[model samples]
Target chain A: MKETLKLFKIGGGVLDDDAQLHRFVQAFAQVPGRKILVHGGGKGASQMLSDLGIAPQMVQGRRITDAATLDVVTMFYAGKTNKQLVALLQASGVNALGLSGADGNVIRAVKRPVKDIDYGFVGDLPANSVDAATLHTLIQAELTPVLCAITHDGHGQLLNTNADTIASTVARALAGRYEVELHYCFEKNGVLLDVNDDNSVIPQIVPAQYQQLKADGVIAAGMIPKLDNAFAALEAGVEKVVIEHALNINEPIKTVLCRS
Target chain B: MKETLKLFKIGGGVLDDDAQLHRFVQAFAQVPGRKILVHGGGKGASQMLSDLGIAPQMVQGRRITDAATLDVVTMFYAGKTNKQLVALLQASGVNALGLSGADGNVIRAVKRPVKDIDYGFVGDLPANSVDAATLHTLIQAELTPVLCAITHDGHGQLLNTNADTIASTVARALAGRYEVELHYCFEKNGVLLDVNDDNSVIPQIVPAQYQQLKADGVIAAGMIPKLDNAFAALEAGVEKVVIEHALNINEPIKTVLCRS
Candidate 1:
């Protein structure tokens, strides 16, 4: 197979619905090359968790997973989300394994906060500690690595993070990692022109307009940071940044947040 | 209010299934006492785990949790399952929080094996190293304790132990520490004569009958061990062990596994 695209960043929406998540995973397994799927939880996990009386806090758009929240987030996002993705790939005849940040020194980071704000444990990756080589070995064995969006900061703490950040960083960590296509799968059709209207799909977004949409308040409620993520991922050396629907990932919008 | 039960053992089944899990937890909350819930996975966890290509391993009827299995198991059984149960309880107007065997020295164990078979890092409680007093203060602040069925040996290794075993041990650690009432929740009716036939519910079985059933294969396979657990719990000084449906745990198994 031609050098495989190494990273796929799936949004929280895609991870929420079991059926959609299973399908997205199946597509990745069919594609030729090494691939890792990184996902987050949409309102499905957040709302239920909130309804359960726990408010989710975020620092720099990543979840601040406290001890109480870590328990829920790990179960919902790490175990349930990660394992289910692996299951779908497996069911589709793909060899895959579900893992956490603690599996084999896979991903490490240091908890980061907004200085004065108390957003529990969110992390910034350690200096070049992500060993994508070992992951490649696993990939060589034909096993797809389904990793959760969490990191261990080495100082006796685990950190909740953005799946987009995790996926793109993993891509940057490997040599020739740039060939990996960074895909952001969500419930909608990429970033929309008018965020107030779900049906007004943008079809494409550039770095400049993405910021403009945020300034206009149309994207502020939800879609802003996610698109910024798609932007940041491209900035971090991913070959292509694709924003698409989980139901129909075959048709992706060219939301290039950066110039290659 | 009466002094609350010191340690609550949360069954994993109660964690994943929120609807059923919430009702049962609320009943405990209304008991006018401090309490803790130690939980395990319902069928969702085990099935999902197998989905990730991690086969279930057991020796002497206890989980032989390996590293690969342990990583996923910790996230699933302890991390995820424990949190969901607490969240559900807290959502249903119960101030619930989760604690694991690894958290704050709550559960201590060693990398133990079953009958000298080397079981990797499955936690143990030994005589008693758990500090229930610290947990008591949290409950006194109106928080419900939800625990995972994991513990550490004196070493830093995480251990994989049976939820029943975890529950029993935690209860024992709390026997004289606090006035504790222990309940065992599962999907099926309390110990049956033949699991193949649910109507063959034993209703009541004395030690001699239990022993005879084990010899006669009537209480064979998994049943004998479960009954043994019930007996062991009684001997360890738990006021009572009720094997009831997790959904409606208000009524316990009156058959009572204890001395007359």
Candidate 2:
């Protein structure tokens, strides 16, 4: 049996609040074992962009990443937020190494192709994008890696990538060498059966049940893509997938997704 | 016998110019042996701060790093400049790892004490600040570490620091294990006998000669502190300190400072 590696990803909600971010960091540090952290860009980046007078570029309904927006997001995610998390983790006795994808050539991505819209500096990860070997060495050396949502093409262009995609891609890449557990921590407790009720979290979710739930309108439209992505990670041999509140990661009232 | 390690420090001259920075990166990748790169923040940070309406705080002619200034500098130095260098180096076939002091707790710092001047969020590195053992491990693994001018107090505050100080401090710390060569690269050819003549590069200067040059009014008052810092590094066991043009590092026409 291989060693277990827990990979936790947090989104904008926890990151936007300092107190909540610190609380999450404390909880994350207490998770005993080899672990990794992936963080998304918060309102800070967008706020900075707005302050700098750079308007958001939207094509249809989707926000497109322009050159200026890319610059701001890169600074916020990789520079401020990443370093802050690393320092906070260090204070809690975890030797956290912060990284962008360009660091150690950990993740090489390609710029998204122009189809109907040209997302100026957005990156999309393909197969074999993550450098699993180097990451394995870092983890085995007792260093917890904290990755930001910034990647680069091998030819010197930095691109903004989706944090969830990065987390799942890394987990999938490491699945062959370790029993990987992918955790998505967000504002909500878990995948709630009733959207309005906070106490209606489904404890366990499997593929068949998930499909049935979607078909019967138990899961909403917004959650389909997320669940699909999670199921894909499970199919790729990740041991388990988890969805929980960023602040209550240690608590048991969360949903766990298994292959069975 | 320990291996030779070359540590190069580059400032705004190269960082502000894209062609010059890429040229330096190409040159850096071709150099043989274990190496590290420490870069100073460029004018982009200040420009961004200005555009964002944050006025720089100054005290008695020296720039003070207040909270807002610290935030912009951190994002610019650690985010844009560091990642850009890393990506360029990777494209040149070097496995470059970008770091702020907070990453891996590699360099812990203390907030500058408020005395006659309150330099808000500025950090001062004390003894045993650099984690040389971890650096040695990274170098041994054949990864070139690129550090920016951002550090952290172990209690989670990211503080802006001086790049030259960071470079020299790292050189002094790593002197015990590696025969270290510290190079400070800038726009000038070298220390000049005639301040106005770019071609009058002084080949070498020892401590005694440096003092005499100062007394003779040959060296400018501004160059005194830099030379003093370089000589201190030599006295602290750093093998050599070189000052040269950033783009002309591979050329031989430069100044080498010795402790003798």
Candidate 3:
């Protein structure tokens, strides 16, 4: 039987560990589907740029990417992130085509100023701009699409974006064609109900419980954004999401989130 | 009578037409100093990248830059050719400094990769890492440092470079020092040189030369690289480079090169 088509969201946490990324690429090469890999270059890029005398400014953790920062980010994301991922996947025998949202008009976006405050060079991706025909061509060629968080204004200019959001939008664009699954992978052992306790695991979150947790503050702190995006995917029509604990790398377990 | 520190570069030909690059970011703000800018983009990046899509794999001109394309050239010369120009002049009136061969611990270069082989990133600059002192403290204080085409290897990550390399490099690094002079303002009347007339009475290159002659003959296409970079600087640099004709941008034009 053929396996399900999946849309994987490789998190910043997974990218933080180079070794795990290497191993994950190995296993992924052995898998199926017209896989689209999207990545986040958090801390890594900002830190390097900072060390080089750049202090990042953002309205809400969203970097106010002007021109200089854009150049640096391009080096990190397009030049470093995508390149490394391509190298790793290629090493593992995967035919991966690394790309930016700008190439071949693959994905286009509108420059978004931050909440009425100009974020200089930041952008918001439009749903219609996600060109599915271009993507189909790549999949038909049997090449894996490894993407970075950066995009373009389509006039030869690039924009900074949240990688996870990019993956979500991409998944949303590509749903229903196949058994599309967006795997949000991180370095944790799974979603932990109790933060302090490592062994505690929350196997699933149904629609009602997902809402209740938000009401009762069971899911407060940082988990808010992740869950919000997870649910956004569910609402957008992806088959389901597997928020797995990618700690061991080899032995990945599914902490599924079903909408019911 | 001493005047302002005016920057003047001789573009390939495009700047001849687009003299608007010179007046873009308020030239009155430049700190009082002597200036002469020499630029080259060869008009290759646009046509060349486009050509590579169709041409055979010729190692020198047609080979596509893989993740490996950036290895040597992106880091080192990106600054030398592109970003440094943007980072250096883009906020001139507002204190965007200049950078080039003479700056403190600037661009370091690694040798070209093996002719046909992928060379791991090369080129060495004095400070691969931009120190807080340069981007933040220094420029904010109203000292304009004009950087020629160059970048550093920060921590041994040497890079190949091109002129007008880091187009928006300066703008992003020093967003606070907003204004910039990226593409086009030059001494020449713009790209207007005689293919056969050689009388040189035009006083400088003009826009007409950019379109008319380009189609007629190759016009020693090697000169295309320099002009190519000047155009990129507008988008890459914090401000716009007023690329004009070479003869009048500044005084004391380097006679040998111009008279060639």
Candidate 4:
């Protein structure tokens, strides 16, 4: 039996709050087995941009990542946040190593093609973008990689990427070698039957149940894309996908999606 | 019988200029065998700090690394500069992994003790600060480590460190395993006999020569600390120390200091 690798992704909610982030780090450090952590940029980047007087550029209601925006986010995500997390993890005895996609060419991305909307300096991962072999080597050497949502074009350009996509892609890439479990940790408990009820987490959802839930409109509209992506990862060979609260990762109350 | 490893240190002058940095990256890419690059913060960090309205704290004419200053420098050095260099190196076909001391517990440092002046968040590396075994594993895995001048207290506190000290210490730590050559790349051609003459590059300097030059007041006051560190690295088992221009690293017109 292949050893299991749990890849956890945290977003703005946990990252933006210092106490919450530390609590999450302490919880994450206790997770056993080979693990990876992917983190998204927090509100800090936007705040810094605002403080520096760089206005956010948007077109057609979609945010554009200009050169200045990219620089700030890169510093915030890859530099300040990532290093801080690594130090915290190390203090917790997890031996974490922080990385951008540029590090070791772990993930090479393609710049978003200029459509009617030019999302400048943004990257979309192509197939085989995650270098699984290198990651495997690092993991085998007993190092836990903490990746940020920054990728490169393999041609000297650092582009902003989505952390969720990075988590799924890395899970899919490593599926052939490890029993991959991808965890999307956020503020909510899990997939709720009643959106207002914090205790209404659906423990398990296979592909058919997920489809039914979506069709029944039981799932929140905001969670549709995330669920769609999770199920796709399940179909693509990832053993399981878990949606849980960042603080309660060790707890049993969560949603698990698997292929039936 | 040990394999050769070239460790290069670059300071603010080259890093602050894009063209010079790219040129140095191109030259560095041409270097063969196992290598590492340690870089100092550029003017960008101070610029960002100023833009963010974080005033530099000083004590008795010595710069103090206050909490605010530490955060900005960490973001600047570990985030923007380090990632940019890694991406550029990746573009140049080198598999580079960026690291702060916190990563992999690579360089755990002690918080500088409060003397007459308290330098908040400044780290002082003691003996065995560099994890040579981990570095060896990374080097043997074919990944070139690109380190920034940020370290951690191993207790979740990130500290600002000097890049020159990091370079010499790393070189010394790895001396037992590799034929390590430490390179300090800056603006000058080499250790010039005449401070104003760019062409007066001293081809080689031994302990005796260095002493004579200092006694004769031929060496500039600013070069004393750097040269002293380089010699200490040599005495500590590093094979040689090279002082060269960042843009002209692959060229031969440089100063090579050796223990004789």
TM-score of each: 0.48, 0.98, 0.55, 0.99
Candidate 1 per-residue C-alpha lDDT over B208-244 given as tens digits, one digit per residue, 9 for 90 to 100: 7778878888765865677787777667776665665
- List all candidate RMSDs to the true structure: 16.7, 1.2, 16.5, 0.8
Model 2, span B1-260: residue lDDT tens: 98899999999979998899989999899889999999999888989898988988889988999888888898999999999899999999999999999888889999999999888899999999999988887888788999999999999889999999999999999999999999999889999999999999999999899988999999977888888999999999999999999998889999999876
lDDT per residue (tens digit) for residues A97-201 in model 3:
555566434567788855657787776887776766656655655657777776766554567777878887887777746557777777666667777765666
**Candidate 1 residue lDDT tens string, A52-94:** 4677677678556677676567766655455445544544655
Best candidate (score: DockQ): 4
TM-score top scorer: 4
Residue pairs in clash, model 4: none
Which candidate gets the maximum lDDT versus the true structure? 4
Q: What's model 1's interface RMSD, roughly to a tenth of an angstrom?
A: 14.8
Q: How displaced is residue B128 in candidate 2, in Å?
A: 0.5
Error of 4 at A59 (Å): 0.6
Q: List interface RMSDs for the candidates, in order.
A: 14.8, 0.7, 15.9, 0.4
Tens-place lDDT per residue, model 2, A22-140, is: 99999998999999999999899988888888988999878999888888898999988998899899999899999999999999999999999888899999999999998997887
lDDT of candidate 1?
0.62
Rank order (by TM-score, best first): 4, 2, 3, 1
TM value for model 2:
0.98
What lDDT score goes with residue B242 in model 3? 45
When sorted by DockQ, best at the front, the candidate numbers are 4, 2, 1, 3
Please tell me the TM-score of chain B in candidate 2 relative to the true structure's chain B.
0.98
